[model samples]
Target chain A: MLLPSRFSRMLEVVSAMIMDLLGIPPQVLFGQLLIGLINGAFYALLSLGLAVIFGMMNVINFTHGAQYMLGAFVTWMLLAYLGIGYWAALVLAPIVVGLFGIVIERTMLKRLYHLDHLYGLLLTFGIALIVEGMFRYWYGVSGQRYAIPAELTGGYLLSFMFLPTYRAWVLVVSIVVCFGTWYAIERTRLGAYLRAATENPTLVRAFGINVPLMITLTYGFGVALAGIAGVLAAPIYQLTPLMGQNLIIVVFAVVVIGGMGSILGAIITGYALGLLEGLTKVFYPEAANIVIFVVMAVVLLIRPAGLFGREK
Target chain B: MPDAAGSATATAPAPAPGPRPVALAVQDLNAYYGDSHVLHGVDFSVHEGEVVTLLGRNGVGKTTTLRSIMGIVPRRAGSVRFQGDELIRLPSDHIARRGIAYCPEERGIFASLNVLENLLLPPVVRPGGMSLEQIYQLFPHLAERRRTQGTRLSGGEQQMLAIGRILRTGARFLLLDEPTEGLAPVIIDMIGKSIRTLKGLGFTMLLVEQNFRFAQTVADRHVVMEDGRVVDTIDNADLDRRMEDIKAYLGV
Candidate 1:
């Protein structure tokens, strides 16, 4: 073997030390961080929906992932079949998906209300399987890419990081949606009624709330939020039928780690865990796949109710 | 000794007769749980401003009657008319919006919500809602624990919170089940006083109680049930004479 040059060896050692100390190059690190934030945004939105459904309806909504995939597919069909643009699809997707949710609630979910929570979970799981299977049969496992809209196609270079404009828009839109939902549930008069019904539907009905309608609407709204998240995610990820499947598992973990105690808690835990996963990617690439699960295990050990969950 | 007090009043003549303007009317009401028929052809009516107590032992259908009125349980056949409006076909929430309120035996308070949130919940409608000061006046203990979560409240405080919450809804009629169950004597006394105060305010009440002594002090009329049917309807004037029968039926 040829002897290595002393100066080249010295340079290699310095760069390796720098990489170890700084975790990763600034561009790679910030890029991953940005991606993490994007992932966090979706996580926050999806988990918020799950928490809302769980709180008021006491349904795990295993169909949530399927509904989210339906949102993306609906948007695609709107564009391809109806010549609708992204903006219109953004508004139409949720309404269509929400109405679908309402129909499900009226027919299938209504029957399971008096039964065990497991039955609801099992029913929704079967729904998820049916939905996913149908989509796979039509679209196949290979994902189709969605072109970024002309208006959102540019990018901005900041320091060493180049941020895509569409990604930034996704970040901004998701935060607003998440906070808007949180405010509706936490601060509004309607929210009070929702909360009351969740606690004691019988008493709330006596107060004239029309609880069955409220239950249907609440489930619809929660599903609509997931649908919104799906639309936002369509351009960033491959529009595959399997897209929402993996995301939902992470979101469930985020919900458990957050304790599903408060809406705000679910959102915050989602983003925070997402950022931690990003950091893990830079420092220990091997752990990136399950950093969220690891964090969930740690949280359960420390506080079984979750970080924000109240101890009974 | 309490039985003697009831008999002393029993000999008095029945108070003024004839149906007062009906506040709530239940005709041939029948209800069931799965295959078990719990309420059968139950008939009763409460006049405006009247305090009617449905008194019976644990399983004699007093609670079921109140639940059926509120549409909490499924009614197989019947007409429940509240203030001349048909309630049997209406959903529970719609029935509630018509100005009927229920305080369940479980004292269903939202344990996660603070006392003030619980009180603030029902009176969301404008113009005739109960204010924090009014609820405070009714149950000062609730006022003290306004910021406290519902689970932290004592049983008496939870009962007060439950009643106090319904009062805020501007509901003209109240359905209260076992308001004094599992409470200390002092707390029960406070609840008794609150009921009297509420009666003084012109609120119509259907109180279900196993505590005959407590019911005796507050009820204007008593309807006793056995086997999902009303066995006797005693005016306050006749409460004492029926004590032996009530004691035997209630097994108290």
Candidate 2:
């Protein structure tokens, strides 16, 4: 949202200093940094959903990637068949996919509650494969383009780099969504119910809260967050059935590094790791893809519960 | 041992004068945890506007009885009539909405929530529940520590919070499991005073306790259980006469 003219002079000096220090061209450094932040936004959004689901439901949601893919596909479908724009699809996709998540939770997930955690994992994993397979069959493996909205189609030229309005919009929206969700779960009365239920569901139910219904709704909301990320990502990445599957493995690493079931941890780690990956891409291109996994391994060895997660 | 069942009608005092209607009645209550049978035909009743205690040794189904009444137990088969509503088939939340509240033995305070949040956690089902101001007035210490995380409070404060949580739920019937367990003597006295205050407010309570002495102070009747069945019922007024018998049943 920033005006390029007002910040260009300040950007000139800062860009010059960073370029000199890093011994790199100004465009390459700032371009990679902006790309890193955009990627970070997605990581933050996806991992936040994973953490919330795991926190409340005690289920490691392997279907999150598939859900993310569904969000993007739904958005594309809305645009292709119904002439819906990106803005409208952005609002509608999450709701559509969230309802889908509710169906999954009520029909399949609820039955596995009394069983072992492994059973839930296996069930969700199986569902993810089926969902991804079905989508791939319908859409084919080839990538489809989703045009950026007209309002956010252009870029702002700065002294350091050209910033896309859509990337800035994505970054701002996800951050707001992430923190807004955190506030809702951690500060509100309904959040109190959720936290209490997370601790002891039987006791919360005895207090007259319908916990099973809450679980269903919670799963829906978490999947809906992934839907938001997917819609935001549609214009940036090619819309492919395997898009969520590819990003989900990385998101899982982020969740682990941030700590399972820790909301703030997921967010902070997602962004930090994204920036770190961007830096790796700049300095050592060979390590860019594996940097996040290396961090996850280190975090696991040092703290199994995650950096922010409380020890049980 | 003296024959309690055979001599019950011969030695038992007549129902107390001006007996109120039964608030809760459990008949032929049977409960199981997985494959293990915990309660075998357990039966008890608490009259309205009275405090009753279930007294037994460890693992003797006192807690199980309370849980079964609350419908928190995994499998229970019995007729638990509350205000003429059959509760054995209702879910725990439904049972709670029917004005039954349970304060678990562990206090069930959330570590992530502050004291006020814990107190306000239970939804008020009826119209007459205590307000936050009234609950804070009852436990001034809780008011002082309102913003403190629930688990950070002392054992006594946590117990008070648990009780206060239910009090705000407007549920007239309370099932308190070992409220004074592991508390200091002073805290126990404070809890006893709170119980008396709750009773004065006309709240019916079914307390499960191993401490018979504490039960004697707050309860109108003590239903003694052994091997998951009620072995004897001692009125608080006649507790002194049957202290040795009650002690023998409690095995303490």
Candidate 3:
């Protein structure tokens, strides 16, 4: 301890300061960790959809944020307008948005495949603007409260923290859905076709598979995933029309860190980064906003292809 | 210039006997890459059970001619008739459904997929393709590494898998682009033997090869392409007489 260099001594002092700040009472630490995990679940779910859609069609899906907002909006409309509860809206909202996604692909996105990648990104950006604009005009950018379903209304008192039953349900269901999607795309025969089509649609099509239709369906599925996440998020967050606006940039960073087109990477990185974000809030609240971007820069410096992206 | 190898083929039976039916027929096939014309009025045909080779130098539209048949490369104007049906208007997959299989130059193997998955992926185009057992028997090395990812196979093994993938499609007509390319001599010999086996099993092939020697061994007929058009057609029996023409066009 007496023989350390000046730089090493400085590093130790800084870490010691960090450790002291990070050392929290169990209640606060556990609660924050759970919050981070919940955020990570949303991140993984959103980024997984982005990766899937990007893999098949090479589209960046700028409308993902809009789709997420639409999920909450759809859920709200179902509950307020039609008196539909959260349980049924959870199942229906995503399907509606997914069908909208299919229509977008068939009418707009399909025409852009032969052109530059920027065209697709720009078109989706425009669509997102239109969707969010329409919602803002009517809803006035205010937060809408979604009542948690009766089944998931209570909180669980764990030894370390008070875990809201709905938040726990969201975490568990998101993990299940994310893994289910990964399994469908990685393990099943249909997944094999999807992966192959992503690599070489021409070759896959040559084998009598309807690759174009599959691409449309894949876009639909990705949008549906975004919608599902939105539905889950409605109860936890104040359901603002602008909720997805800021969250998307963070989700995009998560996708970049995880590696675009790498499913397992996306899932793992999403949760891990969310947990890190949570820890940052407890240890260094001042650096919380830009923490993911800093990690992204470091990861990029080491591996330009991304954490799991294959360098082409 | 007629080598000693020509004698064995000369003495053997014609590659396709008794009123050979045309499996594919291309007429005035014109293709373009954007504004640049690639194939200019190219015409060729492969008969039932015949192994036809399209020989040309690099960048001389040899590969384009094969892609034109598969409809992978759109033709500016021409007719591609497969099994008495017009193929020029059909989509690429529709063309494949007509019992024509294409093996692209890159082998087009999915690196993410295993050998068995790759082999089983392509839908059988017709009913005459080699069975999985037959494919395993033909390339035991493939069977040995069935669970290995497609691109993980040795170049020769991948080539065999590429060829074997289409054979399982039951497609009687196979478009193979440079089957001997970048392969070791031993692999070339094995590939030549495999082509002979396919020929024996009545597979019709349209091969595009810069490897003239490999072409001579498997091709029942040679169609020499220049720039884009069919410049010369040398039946196996007549190649010796046309050696000067082949040499001049292909620079072989």
Candidate 4:
């Protein structure tokens, strides 16, 4: 009887500290986690594109944020100017951005292949700045709002919290896309050619594969992934000229933590770091923004190659 | 410069009765590595259904000759004719499409792919290449470790996989560079037996070798090189009589 009373007293003290001192209920914590997962969906998508591009071309592709912003702008322009719907924009936006990426590869990026990687990075960074400047000039800093589709406008009431239908759809679709890409690159016959080319392009060429063409298509595919992420993000986030700027930095951090040029690493670390950031927000709100960077530093110190990456 | 030794040997057939058509002919081929020249006026020829070995001391352009033939070298001039088609201007992929497969000295096996994936990685440029079953039958060790990563394979198994991969590409003309470079004695014997088996299957091959004994076991002729020049061509039948000459040329 004395032991039971003492245990109850300890539990009561802990509960009081959690409720009164912390001021965040379990429901609120769970809600932030769901929101984090939603953000993570986009991170996984964007970083996966970066990893694929880096894996194949050995180019850092600093223009990825601009490409993501282009995806969102294309979706908005299609709906506003051409009266196209969200469903069509989802498919069309990526294709348009992917083609643009192809042009960039063929005209500018190909010339820098023989040079050091820093040149490619500088060139792409400049391109990103120019593209962002043009968009900002066209459309001012204030963001345009995009309404959610009719089919996914409402919220679903759960026992713990209210979940938006669009956010839930984002989580599901991004996970599917991420895993689908992993399967394609890891399990398919074409994937074998890509993997072989990645290892030794000269040998693959001697085997009669057009490795340059494969590189172009890979860059296009990676850019298209960013476009898809942008379209998925459109309904939730505002359509702004500077929208992709801040997000891209975090995505880069995710890539660095995951390991450069590691596809599965990008996807896994993206989602995991997003969740970690959410937990940080619950416990220490001021450190939420820097939690991912701290994790990145720790991971770098522990394993420079990353959790899933192999050393080159 | 014409290959005078090669021309003289063509008149007297040692292995076969009649003269088979030339499958590959290199004429005055000169290649450079940036400002450094590697091959200068190197000349040789391999007849159809024949296994020819390019024998030389280290850095005498044996590997460069093979790479130049495959169009892998950065700057190579002069003519490389394969089956009446001039390959001097063609890119490596186009040359491969025209039926010349190269197994490099380093044995370029993709570590990312499994053994089976590595075996099946090269696209079939022609219809007459070996099927999967035939390749598996040829290299039983490969079939056993089909799911193992390419680099995880032993040296002998990797060599077999490299040769088997080219066989599946339908390229009857193979340029094998040092296939027996770093293998155990038993594995080298197996490779020699496989080369003989492939010869019986009517494959034409040009090989580069540092091991003269290994080359003598599989080759129909040995073309000796000195400083990127083909100085002599000796038939395999005359190999025993010319062993001292070869040792001098190879500086062994």
Candidate number with greatest TM-score: 2
How high is the lDDT of residue B118 in model 1?
Answer: 80
Could you report the DockQ of all the candidates, in the order they appear? 0.40, 0.77, 0.57, 0.76
Worst 10 residues of 4 chain B by lDDT: B1-10
Give each prediction's root-mean-square deviation over alpha carbons: 7.5, 5.8, 7.2, 6.6
In the range B137-248, model 3's lDDT, one tens digit per residue, is 6677899999999999999999999999888887888899999999999999878877777776667899999887788888888998888888888887787788788788
Ordered from best to worst lDDT, the candidate numbers read 2, 4, 3, 1
- Candidate 1: share of reference interface contacts reproduced: 0.59
CA deviation > 4 Å runs, candidate 4: A1-23, B1-16
- Candidate 2, residues A13-110: lDDT per residue as tens digits? 88789878988888997788788888899999999999999999889889999999999999999999999988899899999999999999999999
List ranges where model 1 is wrong by over 4 Å: A1-20, A260-262, A297-305, A310-312, B1-19, B84-86, B123-133, B241-243
- The lDDT per prediction is 0.83, 0.90, 0.87, 0.89
- lDDT: the better of candidates 1 and 3: 3
DockQ of 3: 0.57
- lDDT string for model 2 (B134-237, tens) is 77767778989999999999999999999988988889999999999999999998788778777766779999999988998888899999989998999899
Which digits, one per residue and each the tens of the lDDT, describe model 4 over residues B199-243? Answer: 767789899999999998889899999898999999898999998
Model 1, residue pairs in steric clash: A206-B96, A208-B97, B6-B240, B7-B240
Going through the candidates in order, what fraction of the true interface contacts does each contain?
0.59, 0.92, 0.61, 0.88
Candidate 2: residue pairs that collide? none
Q: Candidates sorted by DockQ, descending order?
A: 2, 4, 3, 1
Candidate 3 chain A: worst-modelled 10 consecutive residues by lDDT: A1-10
